[model samples]
Target: MLDVCVITGEDGPHTALVISAGGVVSDAVAPPGTPHLRPETITLLSALLIGDWAVADASPDGARIEARGIVAAYAQFHLERSIRSLGHIDRTE
Candidate 1:
């Protein structure tokens, strides 16, 4: 399972979100501030999957963001897989 944690500098905290082989976000910490995953984060996250590392401005709809070419295209699949497994690394306490 993959662990996901949305670290907010405001609160000193540590947790994990498990992404099983099936790609389900079973648990989370609900990181403070935004209840919903930021679209821009998702977009940038998606791009990161392909080793692009290019940052995105973020949006309500993450999938809509354009993917700028990544410098390391070979690793894109690994990043993409991790992004595909994304659900919520953080949840509120």
Candidate 2:
């Protein structure tokens, strides 16, 4: 799992920065029609697909605690909601 920071413009546009557990970072484009998904989800999923992070959850509804506990915690704290819906996707496919 990875840590993610979503950066949004004041008027429009959104981007994501995903930070791997090893400290590598990658930027990603946010999904176009998934408002239920958080920027954190977009960032992490993008990183996983791009091979930025060494781990993969393979699910976007809710990542396993064993696989993405940190991500879950981070999302809950930062995004102020559960990232279940976002956790169960594979955009790269």
Question: What's the C-alpha lDDT at position 91 in model 2?
Answer: 42
For candidate 2, the per-residue lDDT at 35 reads 25
- lDDT by residue (1-93, candidate 1, tens digit) is 112343322221222221222111322444333223233544455555565544433333333322221222223454664343233533221
Point out where model 1 deviates above 4 Å: 1-35, 56-93
Displacement of the residue 45 alpha carbon in candidate 2, Å: 0.6
Window of ten residues with lowest summed lDDT in model 2: 16-25
Worst 10 residues of 1 by lDDT: 15-24
Q: Give candidate 1's error at residue 30 in angstroms.
A: 14
Identify the candidate with maximal lDDT: 2
Cα lDDT listed for each candidate: 0.32, 0.43
Global CA lDDT computed for model 2: 0.43
